[model samples]
Target chain A: MPVSAVEVLDARFDAEPDHWPELTARAGLRADWSWPVLAAQAWAARVPQLVTVLHGSEGPTGVVASGFVGPTTRRHRFVGPRRAGGLGGLDVRAPGTSAVPGWWFDTDDGHGGVHRLLAEFLPGIRRELGAGVCAALLRQVPEEALPLLEKRGRLVRKTEPLAHLRAVGDRDAWLATLPRKRRQHLRRLFDTIDDDPTTTVRTGGAVDPTRAAELLRVNLETHRDVPIIPLPQFTGQLTALLARPDVFTIAYTDPRDDTLLALGVLLDHPELPLARHWSALPEDEGGRPGLYFHFYGELMRWLHDTGRPRVSLGKKMVDLKRSMGAEFTDQYAAALPLVGLALLGLP
Target chain B: MKTGIGRDSLRGMVKTGVDALWRTAYRRVVRSAFATVPFYRERWALGGRTEPRLGSGSAEGAVSTEDLVRAAVDLAPLAGGPTGFDPVRGLGGLLPLARPTAGDGLLVALEHPGARPVWDLPRGWRGCLVDAEVDDPALPEVGAALGAGRPVVAVGPDKALDGFTDRVPGGDRVHRVPRRTLDRLDSGPYGVLHDPVLGYLGVLRDCGLWHLDWTRVYARRTRAGLAFTLLRQRSPRLVDALVGGGVPGRVEWCPRHATPVVRTVAG
Candidate 1:
């Protein structure tokens, strides 16, 4: 019997079952799936959070975090309201971070329990939320999961590409691989901050939550597409996140006034340390220019010192991130509509 | 399922023309639901409905929240969406967009947990969570923020704000705001504003009158008033849902805006 009459239970990250870690690892999920990171993200957003666990007769079959990406961020033209268009339909993406599907399943999912989970249960979620139009928006879904989702009637579209910088040998060895022009360009940007006595970049620095939140808000404003939460909520979330042992901060400060100018938050995974969040003041507003480019130098330096294999740089600035020797991966957003109108009454 | 388009073609179409691909896929899915899904099939057959149209509201009849809630599970079209993050759901993510000048500082007080006012703040301006339903541990921190000397904009219902106002200092700084005012601010000057049920569906402003979002709903003139047919919801399929208490309006054209306009008696 392949998971007939399965039940899906919603559990808070902290209250999840004891075997959750073993289950996650068995399903091949990364460090971002851990309780601390997910809980921190939920608390920071101040949004309601839950993780759906699929239960078959044997035991747990699958797990994924419920991350709501409203019309504000999903941005696909068809999914929004007609007038403001940005305000219609609810889209729930898995994990809500990184360029990977946060969903993981037990190998025993052989009986197409995923199809049942997708076809029947997901809509129950939409109704629970009191949403009329609900869709499952999976980000960075791998190739293997396509048929399972598509047969369930999801409209998958190509999203912006994601980048990863493999931290091999030392900084010198990595720089040697890049073209001469590209190497010189990077060196100049890195040296501008390195040589200047006024500027200082330190990895694993004690970051001021308030300052980091402000810098992040400013940086997010530059990219209007990203959702920027309120200041106090962001600060509170950052406070909890920075307290985690597996998380570290790279701070860029103006030594003269002791003002924190830029911040980068990284999640420590043995193989791939993720650069989760980065923010800086505007260049024209007494902020150092090329800080974004310069931070990668600091990241590489930390990677060499710590002996990590690579860094997941995340999406955007594809050309620039690629030029710095970061490999790119194609990403997609799959939309699976969960409700139909006949159920709402107008035939 | 016989439009000659395969699953692989749909996947391949993702890289090239996405809009066309989605429309095609939606047509196929909707067609399949009307034919295969038990709910859509029986309802449409009784109503003598034929092929369903997209963008326009459904071909079914209107239903009530009670009726829809009763048949919730029966609305699934035999497929899709999620779980995990569905345990708790909260409304209001639109923050206050009020940006205080460099000299004057603004302190936003969220008196209600559900109240989300969009705000674009400068360096000194900050937001404080001041929920009045329970004894929030952050009251002292809010007191500390108020001590910094900034004009406060308290957002919440009157009762909630009363509790907050009674407890917190700086009586003169706190300005209680109503839900309507927040709605107006959120919609902007030109954008229409209407409160949706559970922050999902409700009336929208059009030509200074209230109506359902046409793209998401289809309204038909009935003896009772206007019955709404949900255009694009997936789960429990709602055909014609009678919200009740609405006065029907005449469809008109506005030269100024150059879009179809309706003047309703309920504005």
Candidate 2:
């Protein structure tokens, strides 16, 4: 048993440790786990944000980032908004990201760590968030972690598939590792992108935060039900993240008029460089079709050249991501009601 | 009543205490605003400001009344705890009618009959929709509430507040509120000055100087006027907004007051 003290601190508290970067690197967690990124998310968040730090006798064991999800919070098209003050749940997930659990524990007993995280320390999180927070919504629990979580809470039946692309060696070696169909399709996309005369694919360019946010908003508006982050907050978060040396952008622009058509924001880590956010103009509105694939190809090339192992290609577009040689992880959500009474989204 | 301690020593102590409180509050508000409120997050991002500190010349623009009116709900911090201001109806939700606690006294919320009936009088309180715009029948009732021996706090537009006080018998107890939308941010921290939209900005101390509410609001002097960043309000989030026209006051270190003093400059 990892005998430890789980201390829940306000995610924005000044004295909280900047342990995110180190922990993220060790666990290959997504880019949204960083202190600056979480801080940016917390600053614009309407509800209270908390970070549960599980400290062992040796040092810190794990950290879980969360916030209270208000009743009116419509998280994408699938999740319906609850009645006012009805389901003010503690969301144990990163705000505004592809489905992924916002926790990581470095222990041999993974199940034990998770048990302690949910069963022992959860009530404290609820109290900090407020009494109205009557349930905890844990998103994107991996298949391996499902058994333990399923025993304690209600698991949403649908499974979200998380995508990942591995860069085993140089460009040629990486191509060989992929399936024949995906490899050939990727080559065709790359060739088209390379031969195009009207467009220019520029990697490692400065991203104008406002312009990028506008492009993202356009992309999000394509889906009728999804609510986009207000442009200013999105721009602000991009500004902070993009300023760092490790965070870079790949842009596909119209060289003739210098208009930005597509943009891919990537976070660089020694082990995995993540393609965090991607936005492009639709085909009818002056955007080229092969931009996303080309962006992925560029990411793969960078990983090979930099000797990085893999890239975190975020959620959705499951079939498309799979056709491009990405592996999938079955992700499920677990909702544990804080109060004894059953709540919406719970069993 | 003067002690042996010098004026400078007293001032130093006040400054130290105020600075410490200001720093803690500033960090909390700024960080929270960025995380949950899109207005501040976007504005600060466009301004190229990061890791903000007091007096850091980050060149933040002022928020206008028009902006607040348009994006009132969006202005509310998404994850800001459970209770406080309600996003749908600004100040009206502060005190729900269902729950009424005693010992705090009664609050008379005066509003123009035409305005959205956002004010729901809490238990032990009363709401009278007085047509302050013109001569209305509700004035007598307001006057009656003020005269009733119980402690009463009257809040409304300047004209309405003024009209009630001028006509009412116990007008001295009635508090005059500002006409501006941003200024009427919140109703009561009772005697202290506060903007529900901008958090508590300052308190008018007995020493005849405005003591900045460093814990709840962060203010900066701009060429236009004093720009305020609400340090603590979660709902109806407003940050880096310029107090319209300009606060006609000069901020100075007052040894006698033992804190930073805002001396009102009479135009």
Candidate 3:
């Protein structure tokens, strides 16, 4: 019985309703990430994009930030968002696209006309994209959205467990919410970090592209063997991420040499601040024992003290995340329009 | 009217005669086009269309920068539309066409990735100066250029750079394509097309072309005569089948384009 028009926008920060943070605050939204504005501009400077926003009768509704991604051998396919960068699962959908952290929108855990918005959203982007829809592979979509997609009768969905802490009351209350073992372990971490005169905790600062790049290199080198984003793109993208007023970095540094031991980036939205990316010298720069435990301790403490709701830790490393007393939910992925289609992950 | 007895003079006289003949044919066709179709009529009334200016020494049809730009503006409307304007269609069966003057930039459009390798360009019109679609068999080079974060842009597959940029010669760094690659892309794989308004829209240095999408290319008797359409296929061999005859023609540089999108994030 919803007959209102759904609007598609350019998804830029300066677009309608003017500013992003104010829009989120006004809507009493659940989770909306800030990377789209940052990454879209940075990426647009280098690639072709077909990003769009979904709007209903009330203010802003959903967002789909997509880009042309593929080898020129065939028509480039449009890819959706990813888990590591996005705050995860909004409501908008672009044509032939669904990625981790697929959309960002305002809905009571799936009460909005979100499904209907996607119904109207595809054709618009397809016309703008000037090509056929290959497939929309959305990973880690919210559990709330599953029933809606299931009712449509054409989609492939898989569920995976996602863990994170949704803080309540104070730091003590949050700690109490965790199991005794995790609470004690986390408390011991803070005490050790505090006891170290040589190690100091620094918070409320921006991530430097130079140091951020170095930190990212440390993480990627430890994880895989792929070449990182070249300095220009890396810096441009990092600079955009850093420019957000709500974004801040926390670092464990050696007061002796003034080098970052471990650094974590937190994106502050109305609902929660996500630990978007974090890296450090391996095992505390191959020397320190407490820095790894220290980064998260301070992160949780900061979120609690600042009266924030929670923090999305990240994908994978489940065993470790679980030990920290994080509540876990199953992340569902669905390939849309063309259901049952095997999805190829972004390279 | 002087049958000057010298061989040089005789060559000039033949050239003049051939020029007059081709020009007359060109005018007759275009005139019929404008008078018969509303699309061409409106296009002529507004400005230039690629007439392939005849009145040449070799009777070779060619275009100048002024003419190319003029024609581009003239045919802008037909660039994007599902049906050619007006229902009447023209196969434009075989006609003399002017060779496009090699401008500062050349555009290459084909289905084959690395299609640029098969293209032979005039010295001034090199692939390095082109702003083409993301297709090229020389993808390694394209990928390398992209990886290096060069000034490459991803445009629609249908777009090709016209004699458009003034980015001074020798001012920019370019990865030069060898002549050998263009050699592989040309040869027998060519098909000739003569559009009612744009003249010979297909690539080829000469005429005697075949399999032109005459019905779709010309809209009047064809569709509102307000638009024109030329089809593009993935295989060069398709051109032969579509042409249905063994006549030879070179590749036509298509100028119609959709907006180009640059890839900010690498896959």
| Leading candidate by TM-score | 2
Q: What's candidate 3's DockQ score?
A: 0.01
Q: Which residue runs of candidate 3 sit more than 4 Å off their true CA positions?
A: A1-49, A55-59, A70-100, A104-114, A151-155, A168-184, A223-233, A284-287, A338-347, B1-267
Predicted chain A of candidate 3: TM-score: 0.72
**What docking grade does candidate 2 earn?**
incorrect
Candidate models: Cα lDDT each: 0.53, 0.60, 0.41
lDDT of 2 by residue, A198-258 (tens): 7898888897776786587666655444343422235556666777777778899988988
For each candidate in turn, the interface RMSD (Å) is 19.6, 9.7, 20.5
Q: Please name the candidate that would achieve the greatest lDDT relative to the true structure.
A: 2
lDDT of each residue in B1-267, candidate 2, tens digit only: 887987687678778888777657766776666555665655553344444433434333556544554445346544433223322132333332112234444454455455444443445555555555566676676666666664555555566677766766787876443323333323323323434344334554444445564544676665545666666556666666665544534556555666554444441
Better structure of 1 and 2 per lDDT: 2
What is the alpha-carbon lDDT of model 3 when measured against the actual structure? 0.41
- Share of the reference A-B contacts seen in candidate 1: 0.00
Ranking by TM-score: 2, 1, 3
**Structural similarity to truth (TM-score) of each candidate:** 0.48, 0.55, 0.45
Model 1 agreement with the true structure over A115-206: per-residue lDDT tens digits: 44464346544444455435556566555555666553458877778788998677677888888998998888777778999888888878
**Counted clashes in each candidate structure:** 49, 26, 51
Judge candidate 1 against the unseen true structure and give its global Cα lDDT, from 0 to 1.
0.53
**Candidate 1 stretches greater than 4 Å from native:** A4-16, A21-40, A43-47, A56-59, A68-96, A108-134, A147-154, A226-233, A339-347, B1-267
DockQ of each: 0.01, 0.08, 0.01
